[model samples]
Target: MFRILNNSDTFITIGREYVLEKYDKKREEWLHIPLKANIGFQADGMIIDSGSETSFFASFDTFNYNFPKGDYRIIKVLSSEGDGILLYDDFKIDK
Candidate 1:
């Protein structure tokens, strides 16, 4: 789950855009992990009013893919055409 806060003075637009990346300890860099298939479509636009917030549930299934255990993050794309604000949070896979 993730919460998006709109603290600005004007309305903000958001979409269901994101990419998954894994941290390479050896290289000290993040590498993009391409999805086996398109999980979903991008939203035309979802608006959040000023000083408001919205929460959404997100899940990444690694059952089919052989993803190694390590640190990872979801690069949340907040605009269209892969250009705009980006928000991310880190997570770890112990299993």
Candidate 2:
């Protein structure tokens, strides 16, 4: 899947692309979706991806979170920089 989306700004004209790789040691193929843009908020580290899933934003060095005492699971996802990122979900933030 090689889809291109133009993300141009007043000083630049950039775009995003998605690449797929196959015949590796893993499954049939892999999806590489790169969201190249200069808009909104940016995570210093990395994050997961979804076809149309909503992702939250938070800075551990700035925000305070009261995580419940419960079991959780971590899932890995691909980022725009072609890197694997593990994100923790099912958690709540304090008001």
| Tens digit of per-residue lDDT, candidate 1, span 1-95 | 88989877776778766677889999999988766574564567687788998876665662235668999887776643344778898989899
Task: List all candidate RMSDs to the true structure.
Answer: 3.3, 16.5
Per-residue lDDT of 6-67 in model 2, one digit per residue for the tens? Answer: 23221211112112122222454432322235423333442223332333333332213233
> Where does candidate 1 stray beyond 4 Å?
38-40, 62-64, 79-83
lDDT for residue 63 in candidate 2, whole number 0-100:
19
Q: Top model by TM-score, which number?
A: 1
Q: Distance (Å) between predicted and true CA of 55, model 1?
A: 1.8
Candidate 2 pairs with clashing backbones: none
Native-to-model Cα distance after best TM-score fit, residue 65 in candidate 2, in Å: 29
Looking at candidate 2, the ten consecutive residues that score lowest on lDDT are 9-18
Candidate 1's displacement at residue 82, Å, is 13
**Residue 11's C-alpha lDDT in candidate 1?**
68
Model 2: per-residue Cα lDDT at residue 2: 18
